[model samples]
Target: MSFNPKDALDAVRDIATNAVEKASDIVENAADIIRGDIKGGTSAIVANSIDIATHAVDRTKEVFTGEDDDED
Candidate 1:
């Protein structure tokens, strides 16, 4: 048996490259599925989240200033 460092290095590089490519494909496929699922609900979810956040900020401001903007 002959010990070849170059051959061993080449084999390791090949394995790493293959693993990365497979991982990338898996991630891309998962993203596609998620996009399909969220296609209809994503907009509504985002809108509701924005509204809630805005209301929270407004309430925080009123609490700090002790002034209600609605009375204006």
Candidate 2:
């Protein structure tokens, strides 16, 4: 039973990746509930969903790549 730093870091990265995905789901659902309460808010809700998804993808990429993608 040897301590492997690479394995530890990989495990941590996996956990972080899963967390980010779950958080994004929660935020998207919350936006639905919040926007649903208002009348004629379908467009706003859809836009919010897209925005959250884009951010989640970017964050997940950063987590796996271990760096931020600042390029447009």
Write one digit per residue (lDDT tens) for candidate 2, span 1-72.
Answer: 455567556656765666566567656666766866453345555665666567667665555565657864
- In model 1, residue pairs whose N, Cα or C atoms come closer than 3 Å (at least 3 residues apart or on different chains), thus clashing, are none
Q: State residue 25's C-alpha deviation in candidate 2, in Å.
A: 0.2
In model 1, where do residues sit more than 4 Å from their true spots? 1-37
lDDT of 1 by residue, 1-72 (tens): 354566556545655565565556555555655878555445544554565555555554555555557889
- Report residue 17 deviation for candidate 2 (angstroms): 0.8
Q: What does candidate 2 score on TM?
A: 0.44
The per-prediction CA RMSD against the true structure, in angstroms, equals 23.2, 7.4
Model 1 Cα RMSD, Å?
Answer: 23.2
